[model samples]
Target chain A: MHNRSGLLEACLLILLKENKSYGYNLMNDLHKFGFEEDSLNISVIYRNLRSMEKRGLITSSWAESDQGPRKRVYEITADGEQDLKNWIWMLKNRKSQIETIIEKYENLK
Target chain B: MHNRSGLLEACLLILLKENKSYGYNLMNDLHKFGFEEDSLNISVIYRNLRSMEKRGLITSSWAESDQGPRKRVYEITADGEQDLKNWIWMLKNRKSQIETIIEKYENLK
Candidate 1:
């Protein structure tokens, strides 16, 4: 994704809403959703997760894992759902704008 | 526009392609293209313009104006046109991704 930080956030919200997950699982889900592992920075996702938690969009808690001592589990908050809705609305608006630009480009002579 | 720096660059390129314009006129054109003047930061546009020039996507020159001392005129370079094409391609891809996300959101229950 090219400069898709906001899109990444929206995707994370959607994934968490589907099921509360840990960082590793979320990263895997991101790959499943078209994000290239090589292009994605794990630290960036963690930073975004921390920032979202600070903003009350997500909450993280330590959970005992079968193979590990403990893992941080992330769940979307009500605010995250609302934020996702807002993101969708904004993205829809942007989509139309992009279409307009493309149309204009095609018409250029 | 919410975090639409790339979109802004595309719009600027389109406008410059249409005509080599000065900063003020470009800003006005942007307003006509759905950008709210109040929401836009003039400095950011100038910063982007300077950055584009530095990257050889655009070139600027000082021109004598009818009523002002001199104004900086901006023109899109050949590289800029190619960059515009790339931007359009990327934006098209992003548009489809956005549509997919919107569809997923709508289907969520």
Candidate 2:
């Protein structure tokens, strides 16, 4: 993921890559990734899923979970896999560019 | 910055590095950075500034601009500078970690 906004989505992809999940599971996983508990905005995840679905990257359906209500379960589509692959490629090739920017901003003695 | 959530805030720091700016100006600046006009949420920037101010990373004061209302002109605090420095350092050191993760994600064949 390129930015904080991509965070939830990135996590979503990681989760979907493993298995489809509901909001609570995603939120819990985010906590594992060190996202502040209060800062875990599930709505952002939901919104990103919606956008990704619109882009043919993901698909969702109301599924019954052991927990509360009917949750939206999401799975990665072929396009979603492709998008993730491309993002990873960018991260690989842009490593030097990212390093340069960071070094210019950071002054270590 | 590290993520999209940090985009607005990172842009905020960059802008503050240049000069104090109003909301509209910040929005315009985001457009220059290729943030979709609609995706350029000034509210997130304002919120990050408020949080940064709370953490003593930034300070703001009402400044009379030639525009409509009193705009909050924010400047980076000493702590903010140090935070920026540390973030940059992390960006440098974590480059390999990031690349490794991205590589694990991507399969370019």
**Best by the TM-score measure:** 1
Looking at model 1, the pairs that clash are: none
Highest-DockQ candidate:
1
> Backbone clashes in each candidate structure, one number apiece?
0, 7
**Pick by lDDT: which candidate is best?**
1
**TM-score of candidate 2 against the unseen true structure:** 0.54
User: Candidate 2, which segments miss by more than 4 Å at Cα?
Assistant: A1-5, A32-34, A93-95, A105-109, B1-80, B89-109
Candidate 2 lDDT over A3-103, as tens digits, reads 34243555567667777876667778756444556765777767777888899888889987676788888888888888777666555544654554454
Chain A of model 2, TM-score against the native?
0.75
The DockQ scores of all candidates, in the order shown, are 0.52, 0.23
Compute the TM-score of each model's chain A versus the native chain A and list the values: 0.86, 0.75
- Interface root mean square deviation per prediction: 1.9, 5.1
lDDT of candidate 2 over B1-109, digit per residue (tens): 2243233455566566667766657778755444555755667767777888898988888888676878887888888777776655545544655554454354332
lDDT tens digits by residue: candidate 1, A24-68:
778878875566558677887888899899999999999998896
